[model samples]
Target: MNQQNHFALGLITLIIFLFLLGPLAIIFVASFEPTSVLQFPPTGFSLEWYRNIFTVSAFMDTFKLSMFISFLGNLCALLLGIPAAYALSRFDFRGKGLLNAIFVSPILIPGTVLGFTFLRYLIVSYSLPLEAALFIGHTILMLPFIIRVIASSMANFDFSIEEAAMNLGSSRIGAFFRVIIPNIKSGIIAGVLIAFLESFNNVDISVFLTGPGLSTLPIQMLTYVEHYFDPTVAAISVLLMIFTAVFMFLIERLVGLSHFTKR
Candidate 1:
């Protein structure tokens, strides 16, 4: 009976994997089509789309734009989120619970609404640039995830260690840098990775924040698909999947995925 159950579970997993990955496989295969139109079956294989990607300034620019936005957005979220997480984990204060809830509320908001709200705030109130709008939206959207991850780590951390370091004549800042930071490194890495992924793949928030002058890769793909029904977007998607998978593998090796689980 046990062996039969194991076989059934294995078959279930295989079916699920195929369901999820079959479309991805199709995207990759379609990317190599020689024809201009996006179709599954092709006349022949060609590298023209891949080659043209290098020469396409719009594609290159959007790729860089996405990378730059995710980087800066995650950095800003780290700065804002660490303090908030530490506060929640290490102290008791008036309205502490409320503050925590408010900080993470962005995650609950519909991306479309959040995007439009920030876009309105930036455009009408602050009159900020496109890049600033995107960064602010992404940073806020990712802040909760970072804070939650860090707070979970800090919850498991022993404050006595921090106290001991301080009692030994280490300054508060020194203790933080030496003891606290090292202890929370895994959580920090996880937060940063999650933040980057959120920023990188965001479409709804980005769509509202984007201006006519600037476009992100996802938005650019959307724009292209509206006018041109080509498989270039599929090719780009394949490249991004490869890059993301490689990075995730590296992250898994660096910090086991189990580390994110609550203790």
Candidate 2:
């Protein structure tokens, strides 16, 4: 009976993995199709679509823009979230719960609604530039992950460490920079990696905020799909999958998958 159950569970797990990864495998194979159209069990293998990705000016331009937004947005989130996480984790204060809720509201809200709200208020009313709007939207989107991850790291932290550092002649800020920050370095890296992935692949917010001459990679991919039915997008998807996998591997190496799983 035990062997039967174990075999069934193993089979189920395998099926689930295939279900999740099957489309990715199809896309990877489809990207190598010789013809322009995306086809399953590709007619013949070729790297034409891969080469075509570079030839498209829009893809390169949007790739640069997406990279810029994702990097800067996560950096800004880390800067703000570290202090906020420290405050929430280490101190007691009035309205702390409400403040935390406010910080996390972005994740709770649907991206489409949030994007529309930003478009109406920031773009139409205040006349903010597309770049500025995108920056702010991505930053806000990242805040929840940053704060939550860093706060989790600080949860078991000993407050006395900061006191000890201060007693040793370090200032409050000095103790934070020298001791607290270094201690939670893994958490910071994890948060930034997660947030960067989120921001880079974001389409809902970028779609609304994007204007003429300013678009994200995901948005451009969507546009490409609408107008053309080709394996180029499939090739792009394959590259993005590899990129994401590499980042995930890095995160696991730096912070350990166990760190997140334990939380």
Q: State each model's CA lDDT, in order.
A: 0.86, 0.93
lDDT of 1 by residue, 74-142 (tens): 888899999889989999999998998899788888888988899889867899988888888888888
Writing each residue's lDDT as its tens digit, candidate 2 over 1-263 gives: 99999999999999999999999999999999999788899899999999999999999999999999999999899989999999999899999999999999999999999999999999999999999999999999999989988898898689899999999999999999999999999889988998999999998888999988899999999999999999999999999999999989988887777776576
lDDT, candidate 2, equals: 0.93
| Count of clashing pairs, candidate 1 | 0
User: Lowest summed lDDT over 10 consecutive residues: which window, candidate 2?
Assistant: 254-263
Question: Which runs of model 1 end up more than 4 angstroms from their true locations?
Answer: 1-8, 261-263
* Top-TM-score structure, candidate number: 2
Regions of model 2 farther than 4 Å from truth: none
Report clash pairs, candidate 2.
Answer: none
Residue 206's C-alpha lDDT in candidate 2? 87
